[model samples]
Target: MPSRWLLSILTLILASAIVVACNGDNENTETSGKETDGGKPDDFVTLKMIMPGDESARMREFVDNELNDRLKNDLNMKLELTYIPWGSYQQKLELSLSTGEDYDLFWHGTPFVSGYKSKGYIQPLDELLQKYGQNLIKNIPAENFKLDQIDGKQWAIPSQAFTSAGKFTSVMVRQDLLESVGMTEIRTIADLEAFYRKMHAIDPSYYGYLETDRGHEVLWRELSGENLTAFDERNLFAVNEDTGELVNYVESDLYKKVAHLREDWVKKGIIDKNLVGNPQSKIDQENAGKLLFRVGAVSRAMENLQTAQKADSGAKLREYFLAPDKPRYIVAPSNEAYMIPAAAKHAERAMMFMNWILKSKDNYNFIIFGVEGKYYRIENGKIKLLTNDQLMYEWMWRNKNYFTAPTNVPDDVVRDMLHNDDNAKISRLFGFHFNEEPVKKEMAQVLTVYKEKFDLINSGLVGYNSGFSSAMTALKKAGYDKVFAELKKQFNEFNAGRP
Candidate 1:
């Protein structure tokens, strides 16, 4: 009924309308793919995280079924984990980062922090943390965050554990051995020594102390109350509490006393001679129920007690602070932290994951303990572990502030040690981080000298004064003076800037 021209115009109009309508539909679909809450679409991201430990098959299953399901539904992301054994962790991490591997996150510690930051292997987290890590900022204290900063930029987010302000050193003694020795309590180092001597005297076959090469270093730190600064990589330097001057920790009076005591103990048959080079001997003795006293961290004490109980039902354990009179707590620079490499493609997503983990109790608990009904169960407001077979490595993503207490330790004991109000004295040099750049060469030379010379003195194989003099002479020859001067200058600068 219409004219030919009118019919042609109508056909063009319909075609234009269809094209505009299709364009509108495409725009709507694209917008829908992005979430309004800043999250991505389902299955849009797969994050790779490398951690230190053997990968648990059970954990992998749970993550695939339980964790990924939730992450996919909520954040549109999933996690891929690569576990490296402790011995191979450092080497593998270096290799992975150097090769520009596509990793989103990894566990970091003190030894790696300075090196990683200085070399620009990791990115500053200031903006990412501000945008997505509000929960972390709220939960962790501002001062605690200062520990992760290098040159005024944050490179890592510290795990929610006792970083630098908790009781670390404690002596766990065998209760049955103490009772046999007629000792009720060990209040001081002298009391402990007496107990050890009595145990040895009662039974010549029983060793008084099971000493380990690394345990001795912790004991020395507890006794000296001096933090190992950058200049003291070998832990041979201490700051004078009175004058704040740098002093050789091995040459100090306290160190001399402890070293002499160790020497006397070694001669008196209190310490096993094989312990000097054989660190595993301590573990062997502990399992054999021959260990009388062991010095280590509070959690280690608890773990030892558990191990001792499993070995001998009659075994009982008691803990005591080595320096109860002057409780010294060093806020450690690193515990457990999540770091994003500079080459990571999913930096924002990694931070989002961290923020979500910190913010959600269910998420954190799931990561820490595993699937609630399967791996653990709640009993009377405490977590009762169901099986140790496929346990989540707590240190990998633990937040002690919101952690649930395990059944292996009493709730009260966990609270007392974790919230150690009585002995929560922050060190005078609490937040000081030693820049290793200035003295890198000196540090390497000194470390070699320390292992060759100072380790003997520390292990009580050599006399204190003679070994100290010899080690000091070697250190001086290795340019110890230069290292000390640089450290002192830095310390002064840090002190001047302290608020």
Candidate 2:
């Protein structure tokens, strides 16, 4: 027989425990670090970040060694990364946000950008930018950051990406493979098909270009002259810039043509029969002298080709943009940004550490690639890159523009590859941020349908041999119309408000 008062007190304690368990926010309250090196409180602070992959571990080592040990010691600050594996990263991030756990900064862009902003998971960063991050504010072009804003409130910092010639998504061809087939030039998609046909003539396993497992969306972008992507819209379709009207890609003739093109190739045995079921990473096998080309990043294409070159003396890899001859407007935008969470205990201190990292050349390299002579080295004044033998972590964790100083990459190599004369005309449409708040639900639904069915259409599984009309019809049935209408409204608003 417990007394009523005692029972009530016990119940209160139990309820509080249950609440805490459901909230899952103990990490923030439990994790706190002070500035080191006998530095003043104002000079240094510890900032926690959630980045994708174990690559953060290498950054940690660099921060502890190059920055924290000496310069950061007096500043009393360090940058800590809570590594999130890419496989289940989004799930984990969503959990942290739902539970209101503390996160000072995290990597984000594009696919997850609109959703996170709509859910209020990330804070608007305009005030912070205007205040502690003036250096960053000045350095990053206004157009780049403006794309991430909604209603004048900046939610995230733009990641470093060159909008012009540095646009991602290219066809990395094994020059060795092409030469073997007596094909020296590949400039357009049709040329690519011809190359594939040649390779298949030699052997069925020899594909001209292995399509990206999840690259159906890119197919649509190539046909449609639009770069802006929104889930609640026809991914391959958009409002025609000249007409300011909605274009349904799922119903477009281009979709049918590309679909048939892929099917025709599929019949020729040039495309890997197992491609529909293979993961995106499997395309790397093509780089190992198995296939002619793979849909991948130009940077990654070089990385893979460089590896193959080492393994086989005769093997060579060369990259060709989707259309090198004709001027195509590539979607070149930043990919990742460090954003301070609403629950960060020391926002100012976190900003200070970020400022220092962006300002200090040595610290930036350490944070990006890690200790010199270990992850990377400078030989004969050339950036001699090393293999990912444990220390050389995530490649995308840092890039040339993000850090205080560029890595040891050769100037001639960078100029020839990233800023070649042909790519010089590339330009970016900055400040064209699309606010998805009005159609958040529709956007979520749109993404769901795309993930469920678009892969089949793009991989030539469901729409095999059929024209783009059939593919477009399938998407319409999947609720693409609802999504497109919403996107059209927002795009119009964005264009009208453009400066």
Q: Residue 152 deviation, candidate 1, in Å?
A: 1.1
Which of the numbered candidates is closest to the native, going by highest lDDT?
A: 1
Error of 2 at 237 (Å): 2.8
Q: Would you estimate the TM-scores of all the predictions?
A: 0.78, 0.74
Query: Candidate 1 lDDT, tens digit per residue, 346-431?
Result: 77777777777777778778776778898889887777767543434564444556766666665545764565544344444545
| Model 2: lDDT of residue 98 | 67
Prediction RMSDs, each to the true structure: 15.4, 13.2
lDDT of 2: 0.53
Clashes of each: 2, 11
Write down the TM-score for model 1.
Answer: 0.78
